[model samples]
Each structure stands twice: as C-alpha cells, then as structure tokens.
Target: MSQRPRPCRWLRRPGSDLGLRLTLAAAAAVLLLVPFTVLMLLVATAWPPLLALDAHLAATLHAGTSANPALAGVLQLWTDMFAPGPLRVLVGVVAVWLWWRGARRVALWAVVTMVAGGLLGAGLKLLLGRDRPEFLDPVSHATGYSFPSGHSLTAALGAGVLLLIFLPFVPDASPVRTQRATRWTIIAAALIVTVATGLTRVALGVHWLSDVVAGWTLGVAVIAATTAAFATWRGLPARRSPQGGSGRPPPRDMPGRT
Candidate 1:
C-alpha cells in the first residue's frame, strides 16, 4: 500500500534564526518610533528651541534660494520628482514586477509598506495641523499641513523598499571585495536619495528640518514593522539568501520548490 508523504521539515520546524531577526526588527521599530513621538510632542507644544531652529534654518535657506533662482528651480524639480505620489506609483510598479518574478510575499510587503506609510503620514499631518513655512518671497509652494514632509517620507520609504528587495540579488560570495563594494554602493545610494529628498524640501522652504526628520524616522519604522511581521508569518529569517537570489528562501510548499 502506498503511504502518505510526510510534510516538509520546514513546515514542521521553522528556521532557527527567524526569532532573532524578528526581535531586531521589532526593536528597530520601537527605537525609531520613540524619537518620532518625542518630536511630535515638541511640535505640538510649540517648544521654543525647536521652533527657533526651524525658523533659523528656514530663513537661512530661503535667503540663499530666493537669491539664486537657478538653485531654487533645481530644488523644486528635485522635490517634484521625489513627491509621495510619484514614489507610490513607482512602488506599485515594482510590486507588480516582484509578483511576476515569484516573490509574492516580498511584493505584498512592499505594497503594504507604501500604503501604510502614506496613510500614516497623511494622518499625522492632519492630526498635527501644522503650517508650512511662510515667506514673503517663497522659493517654493506646497499646499498642505507640513509637520512630517510627505516627500521625505516617500523618498525614504522608496529607497528602503528598493534596497531590501534588491539586496538579495547582491552576490555575497567568493569575491569578497566585490560583494562588499556592491552592498555598500547600494546602501550609500539609498542614503543619498533619502537625505537629499529631505534637504531639498527644506531648502525649497516648504518643510522644516524637524518635519523631514520625523518623516525619515516614521518611514523607517514602518518598514521595520512590516519586515518583522512578514518574517514571522513566513517562518523565515529576515535576511538575504546566501545564493544571492530573492530576499527570502522559497519554502518547500512553494510551487517550484521541492
């Protein structure tokens, strides 16, 4: 008589390293959230020092940008390119591509991260009801509450999502130097984009420094939360595969896996 096939060992016992990564991700989320919460309280209370810093930077940048129309124009263009709406669309396209490539879980995680970040940013904006910097000769104009900069939040989220999704493809193998170079290059590029987005928003005089900082922290925190949740659900470690493939290993239950 034919006997029933046994279940895959993975299903019976999850990867051993998942718990540590999950804990780390959770810790990251809390760490990011703490500073963001503090900032929110300070902004809500109109803390004198924070307000003074915001005024000082906004005035300084405005003075320079307003004098140099060319620089202001360039910053405006950069801000438009990295706006939350465009970034969300780009992330959606990437999610579709990921799904087609059989990284459905990662794709889903990407979608969730973008959607959650967008909603959270908007909610905070409404809750705070903060005003954008007002200038007699404003270098740039944005019509919305501006406690946490939407552009900054979206840019950070976009960079982070792209990094995590593509990291698995970095060949971490025999060529140690090449692998390190590739990984650091990707990391640096992401950092540059994220930081530049915030700086441009501030230089354009549309967002305060604190606004940009809050956006950065919140965006990262959201990513960490989702990553931890996904890792736990999949019973997989939150790490890139040694094989330099997708972000996570295919479970035995997956169609192409054996």
Candidate 2:
C-alpha cells in the first residue's frame, strides 16, 4: 500500500511558524496604533515624556551650534538632501529603473508607498497645525506645520523601499547562512541612513525631537505594512490561463526541471 506523503518539514519545526505569526500580528498592531498615537499627542499637547525629551534634545543640539559650526553646516546639507523635491526625484529614478528591469510589481509598490506616505505626512501636518521649534536658534530654516518632519519620513520610506526591492537579489546558497548575513548587512546600512536622516533634522533645529520620532515611527509602519502586503501577494497560488490549462509543460518533462 502507498503511504501518505510526509508533512512539510518547516511546519514541523518548533517555534518557527508561531514566531512568524506573532511578529506579523505585532507589526499590524503597531501600524494601526502609531499614527493614532501621534495624532492624539498632537491634539492633547500633553505628551510629557516626548515633550521633555524634545526640549532636552533641542537644547543640547542648539548649545553645540557655536562650537561646531562646520558640523552644523554639514548636517544642514545632509538634511536638505532629504527634502521633498529631492526625494521625489530619487524615487522616480528608482521606479523607472525597476520598471526597465521588468520588476513591475516592485516598481509599482515603491511608487504607491512613497506617494501614500507623503500624502499621509502632509495631511497630518495640515491637520495638526503644530509649529516648528522656536525655543532656540535654528541652524536651518523651514516653513509649514511641523508635527511630523517630512524629510525624516521621506528618507525612511525611500531607504526602506529600496532595501526591500534589492534584498531578493542577494543570492542564497545551500546553507542559507550567507543569505542571512547578506540581508543583515543591507539592513544595517539602511538603518544607518534612516537614523542619520532623522537625527540631522533634529540637529538642524528645524524640527522638535518628537516630530522626528513620530516621522520615523510612521515611516516604519508604512514600510512594514507594504512588505506584508507584498509577501502575501507573492505567496498566492498562480492561476491558469483562460484555456483552463497551465501555459508551461509539466515540470518533470521540462528541461532541467528541479
């Protein structure tokens, strides 16, 4: 008699499936909650911890301005690179490149994520109507409501989308260890860029510390949600053509079929 096929080994692995399920659930929770928290904080104007942290950070950064004019100037330049116009241009270029390479799905994902994140940030700014930091001299000048730093949000989204698009290109070997290492390296580099961009806004005194923090958190939520959506799409079963048949020959009969 024929025996039943063995269950998938991954399903039998201890904790792996549970861990992934929990992680995804937590990410969804954060994605839903962070924006609401930011909005409520803006309305209440009573986020004591964030307020105190903002005051201390802004004061510390401002105090260093005279002693480190050159450093301040460098940070100003870095912060400017994340401005909305520059970020739009950068995203446009990347999306076009991905399209040319036939990564249509990823290209569309990038454009949608960037545009949605920008609109969300802008809507928040207009709705909140919070003013920029004026407690100390600003190393750089800006205009507009400043509850969320647009530069920080754009930087995080751009860096994150690019990383996600390129991650699949890292080759996986049999052991899987090398692939994990490569992915971690890319993650580390992206984190550095995102963190530096947020910190520069604070150092320039154009945004309160809380604004940058909120921007980073919101940006991360957008990225996490986008990634989850993409993964779900990719996991879906492929559909047959209108003829009700697969377009390709049976895998076992195809040349070099795995």
Name the best candidate (by TM-score).
Answer: 1
lDDT of 1 by residue, 25-77 (tens): 89999999999999999999999999999999989988999999999889888
Q: What TM-score would every model get versus the actual structure?
A: 0.86, 0.75
Task: Determine the C-alpha RMSD for candidate 1 after optimal superposition of all C-alphas.
Answer: 8.3
**Candidate 1 error regions (>4 Å):** 1-14, 236-258
Q: What C-alpha lDDT does candidate 1 achieve relative to the native structure?
A: 0.83
List where candidate 2 sits over 4 angstroms from the true fold. Answer: 1-26, 29-32, 35-43, 173-182, 232-242, 245-258
User: How far out, in Å, is residue 218 in model 1?
Assistant: 0.4
Question: Lowest summed-lDDT stretch of 10 residues in model 2?
Answer: 4-13
lDDT of each: 0.83, 0.70
**CA error at residue 55 for candidate 2, angstroms:** 1.8
Each model's backbone clash number: 0, 0
